[model samples]
Target: MDWGSTPHSSTMYIWHLEGLKKMDLRLRAFLAPLLFCLGFIPLWGIDIQALVQEQVKSAGLADQLVSVTNQMLEGAIDTGKNYQQVKQLDKLYQETKNLKAILNPNKGASKPTGLGAVFKKAIEPPVDLDKALNLTNALQKEVKNANQDGLDYSKILSVLNQLENSLQTALDLKSQWLDTRKAN
Candidate 1:
């Protein structure tokens, strides 16, 4: 099949047809998976812009929690009246409840399991939710145990300091999360 010696003959035509067939098969093999992967992009891709916006909102909420905690500490320190102290404690409790709501919107819902849990954990920021909740609980307990005759301002101050510190830690976590998101 000396196709090179007979470039204008039927043998040359046959050789050219074989080369075209081989190239066509290689092209199809390379393109098929590429097309399949492209088709799945819409299914798996996350909206980075929306995620960044959510991070911003979370950071702002963390800041607000810190501010409300500071106000609670100031209210406890400046007022010696029992009724006023009770009122301030109630306000602080309400603010903590609000912060919890903002941080975990599905608080009462059953937690995800298996692969769903893994994915949820992967997306969540590295913050100690349990520590924050425990701090809030301690604050509530301290306020409830206060004496009506004369509130123990020192104990209340100590609990308030712990709550403030927990809130500050949350704020720091949010800030770090935002910074990481921006960098990526």
Candidate 2:
């Protein structure tokens, strides 16, 4: 069979090209308004770099809290247990308070306050917002319990570990989100 003599093949090829052209037109038509609406809407329009930086700062503060708590635990083990525990509990309280202030600057305050408060205002919530909040609250309660009874150092340490984990998780999620957004 001679290739040029096949009229049916030429017709089929023309039909395929026509079909592709139609599909291309339909896709463009569907995407035009969607792209336009996306342009008008601001979803992740905030400066993600700033948000990531804030999360990093929060994570650093949480790390400090963890370090101090570990020191306190060592002190309790080596020195006067009750006195050392009380002092460490106070320090933990202050560090956790600062962490909370960083996490939720608007809480119990007239307005945002901190180095990254303005950026925090615009930043979207991390994937683990609820988890972070609950863990932070649990940490506070554990600190309160430790302060009141001066018992169960193990329990306090466990709660501090959980809080630090949550903070680190949030920081990781936020950083990943920022990296993805930047790549796009």
Q: Which segments of model 1 are wrong by more than 4 Å?
A: 1-21, 45-56, 71-125, 129-184
lDDT of 2 at 50: 49
Model 2's TM-score against the true structure: 0.39
Provide the overall lDDT of each model, using Cα atoms, as 2-decimal numbers. 0.59, 0.62
**Tens-digit lDDT track for model 1 on 105-154?**
54566679999988877876554445555655665565567554444445
Model 2 regions more than 4 Å off? 1-82, 111-120, 123-150
Indicate the TM-score of model 1.
0.34
- Backbone collisions counted per model: 0, 0
Residue 143 miss distance in model 1 (angstroms): 8.3
Q: How well does each candidate superpose onto the true structure, as a TM-score?
A: 0.34, 0.39
The alpha-carbon lDDT assigned to residue 27 of candidate 2 equals 97
